[model samples]
Target chain A: MPFRHLLLSLACFIVFSCKNETTPAPSKATSQRPDPHSLADPFNDKMLELQLKLKVDFDKKILSGSASWSFDRKEKTNEIIFDTDNLTNRKSDPWERRNPNHLYARTP
Target chain B: MTLGKEETPTTFTLEPRDSILGSALRIKLSPNTNYLTIHYSTLPEAAALGWMDASMTAGKKRPFLFTQGQAILSRTWFPCVDSPSSRFTYAAEIETPDGMMALMSAKNPQQVSPDGMYKFEMDKPVPPYLVALAVGDISFQPIGKRTGIYAEPSMLKKAAWEFADMEKMVETAEGLYGPYDWGRYDVLVLPTGFPFGGMENPILTFATPTVITGDRSLVSLVAHELAHSWSGNLVTNATWDDFWMNEGFTVYFERRIMEALYGAEYVEMLAQLEFWELEDEVRAFGEKNPDTHLKGNLKGRNPDDGVGDIAYQKGASFLLMLERLTDRNKWDEFLKNWFQANKFTSKTTEDFLAYLKTDYLEKHGLTANVDEWVYGPGIPANCPRPNSTKLAIAEKAATNIVNAIPATKEWTPHEWVHFVRNLPKKTTVETLKKLDSQFNLTNSGNAEIRCAWYDTAIRRGYVKEILPQVEEFLVGIGRRRFLMPVYTALKETGHVEDARRIFTKAKPGYHAVSYGSIEQLLK
Candidate 1:
């Protein structure tokens, strides 16, 4: 009884909607103005590669190493990145730029 | 429900969008993907190595690599959002040695690759705290049909043999709550250096070596972490501000499980010990910050740091009071319903209280402002105080135990030996003397009380008389059952030798209750 409204609506929608026929089309004015800023989700596609690794040795009482990571961001956008204050830039070879502030930043 | 949708990179334009809240650029998301990734690491510090593990007395820094060891440090082991609301499924593939086994937050471990790599996939959405990885020379022993795996070469057989009861424990939990969505469970014992004793990473758990007392009697830590699968891993705190959502509930559930498995008296004794632990911390000298106590400011108090007595004590106490406020029979049902509605999602103090009010107190024929009691701190001054009469009786018994020393008007070597064997049920001199004649009490005496007696005993020639017990006392004080008294005695005596022994034997234990004293003593 407490969820009567939700249950009633769901039941009616399921029973009536399943009877399938010609669907009503949106009006011309309403259909023409689509929102442009709506963006697609980022996690789709196997484009970027991600890997998390660990190295620990108890015999030597050693727990040390860096998390090896390699990924290619096809493009850039404002994403809530995972960054750490402890990261050190070891090397970029001959020439490489660094964006240590962003966890989701692209390699340069 | 379908959560967030992904989009193609080309779906949005190249231009950046402006926002009032600092930088605002919308991502062109994709529809196919339903996951997120986090990375962590650490930089060099001069005193790091010494602080990570200290052999010296005073100035020592030991080097520690939280994620660097597990290779998750690149993303900082903490959840990226700084909130528990951000829960996501993760799959990790570590390129480690073929000999070394790497444990991840995986429900299932896929086959080891021909290239000598392993890929582990975790199906449940887990918080960062619950996302753990351990790389070590380890092996596994499976427990029956349901409980999938337990990895620890040294203690694998012990862990398997000990936790054989876990399948039933989980079933009991499910019968009380609901079916545990995560199919199977296991525990991975990490090396001694692992900071925390146990990380309840859903199906897989990372435990500390220090906790595995070869006899495996102290397997309750396993129960506690397993309880978190429902209390924390299933439904998490939305923000660190609501740490109780995870810890408090877990403590409550852990106590219940312990009570069910190990008898109510043992659990009650454990609860009493937990209460005393909180009492000691609150009473620590110079710990004047009311905010630090339980009431003042909750902001900036890191989730990990706040796991001190405040979370364990205040949090568990809060849930106990909630149970008192509602019907006992209905409480379990309410929790199950709450989990059914909110599992695998982040929640706040207010959110939990609201549900409690609606589904519990109100429905159970009770009228109380539950929020005021919980969100407020230091306990209601007017709340029912513990029975002082009972406390007085116990105090009297304890005092008698303390005063009952039988050797030489002061502690002597022979007397010390007897005292350890005939340790007082309560601290009293008579109790200490009763065992002095026949048994080697030196080996059996509680560390805390002996330490308490150290100063007086030293003044009364007790230290010189029973120097060996003082040494043995320091080493034997690791048990939680005797830590409080031993700590008090140590503080009182200030004996350098005794202090050194504390350091030598200060191995962190499995229970959160055990670690409090060792870490505090180290500090």
Candidate 2:
């Protein structure tokens, strides 16, 4: 009975310590630590079909293109991720920032 | 952009994937996400795309833009699985000015239409490296039934004449290999400073104007790219480590194509040139240098670092030795079968060895030290030597020059390659002048011969009379094959000031591929 109580107390201490730990918010300054699941492509979860519509502006030296990717889901997964750097509405190249929903996390 | 299973819009981020290469993407999506749309643009400094203004082009009226996607640079231009292992068919819709036309490594439209938007389709599933695009005031001229050449309106006729034998070359290649899988093989002669000699983009080859020497002497560049249709475009290397699989096989096949069109002796001269360059590279990178290995360990490094003479010369030499070991007919048959089997698939060094073992060594009782050839640090001891009997004549003539015995001679491009390559290292300026007067090498239209002469002059400090011509050649052409040795020789001979001056003028015109190396060299 005493051993079981001690074990329960130790588990409680570990849980309490873990609960006190906090994760820093994601930022533009990328973390040096690599993500465990980071890979060349995230589209491998399903068979995919892609379409891209692009326009070149010589004066500005920018190539703006619209990419559409359609995938057929096969498994039971909540979220699917793709690799992107300058494709979002964050900064430079200004990707439809006039609208809302611009929350992104540096996947480290 | 639409995001997840509910078709809701969201954002994404780029995560650092590998250390040396570019980044990867991470986007969150819903479980049943059928489609995600992204509106994107490439920056002006995008590594894969090169934009040349009107001033930089032959036709100063229309601007030029082109895309180079090989060796993982494609990711910088756009987002995708930018690896050689990932392949998918693509179609492009490019909008250009009314007078200009856009072309890709795909089925190109025949004539210019009222709408400036050019639509191109590539049915073949190719890796990102092969997705090439070039847009400019381009015109095409038919050489033979299935072969043609494309260039600016001013240079079209000359390019057509220079590549008159394209059809014959293609037929000869088909006769050796199986068939010309890519329909309507065409050539695009970019501006004078179009980086490489020839890029093996499928359906169309992007070539440099330096190869249009009027004498058709440098058409070997064409042969090399045609050979790539089988080795690189059809059967590709999965990563840069197995680069020799693309180049070595292409070099061997290139020599065969040359031998079929031209004579054996002509190919022999070219082989001798390859030998000298390989020796120079092996000396530069010591015999024990890991970079000397055919199947290189190029992880976490610039893939371009592996683009050296070892993969080209030593790789071809290994295959040549294997050919010498087996019967000629059987070797040809094996190569034909190999190409047909691995068509449109990516391969690794290990995969090739397994094929060789199962397909040839075990079955036909053939033998080769496959590990020593591919995985070892240097050239194998038993590498088959290339013979250039005509080069022997040139060597004899070169020896005769030092002895003050002038032998009367008629020189072709092959002989010039041999004579210049065999020139005495310590030949005085006066001697070069005498040879230059006799052969007119300083004024030679051939880029290879001119490069050889400039390399010699740079080493010997005979810059008095040749400086003007050398400077012109240096600033005019941006091919690393021609520029690298000259700049190295200049630096070695204590002419950093002169090399820097020329590179300053030339750097703006060079593609990023050539610019990156020369920038470091001049620095």
Q: Top model by TM-score, which number?
A: 2
TM-score for the B chain of model 2: 0.95
Off by over 4 Å in 1: A1-81, A90-108, B1-79, B108-116, B148-151, B209-217, B282-296, B381-398, B402-492, B496-523
How far does residue B320 in candidate 2 sit from its true spot (Å)?
Answer: 1.9
Show where candidate 2 strays beyond 4 Å: A1-39, A42-50, A70-97, A100-108, B1-7, B16-19, B31-35, B405-409
Global lDDT for candidate 2?
0.74
Q: List the residue pairs that clash in candidate 2.
A: A63-B41, A65-B40, A81-B27, A82-B25, A82-B26, A82-B27, A83-B25, A83-B26, A84-B14, A84-B25
Assess the local accuracy of residue B498 in candidate 1 as a C-alpha lDDT between 0 and 100.
61
- Candidate 2: tens digits of C-alpha lDDT, residues B1-523: 3433333444444443343343455555545456555555666667677787777778888778888877767765666665565566777777777877788899996566467788878888777778888878888889888889889899899999899989999999999988999898999999766778888999999998888889998898899999999998999987778899999999999999999999888888889878887988888898988899998776545677788889999999988888888788888888899899988887888888888888877778988888888878776799877777777888887766677734555667778767776777777778878878887889898888898888876676677678789888887787878898788888888888888998888777788888888888878
DockQ of all candidate complexes: 0.06, 0.15
Docking level for model 2: incorrect
Across residues B1-523, which tens digit of lDDT does each residue of candidate 1 receive? 1111231112111112111001112222233222332222222321111122322111122212223211112133322322245455666655554554556666545233345466777666665455565544456666756574444355576556656777777876777678878887777655334445566777876665444444344466777888888888888766555666677778778878877877765565556556665666666623444533432233322234455666666677766776776567788888889999998886777788788878888888877645545655454443322232323334443345555433333432223323332334333444334434333434433332344454334433344456666655444333443444444555556554565455556553112234555556545
**Model 1 per-residue lDDT at B37:** 28
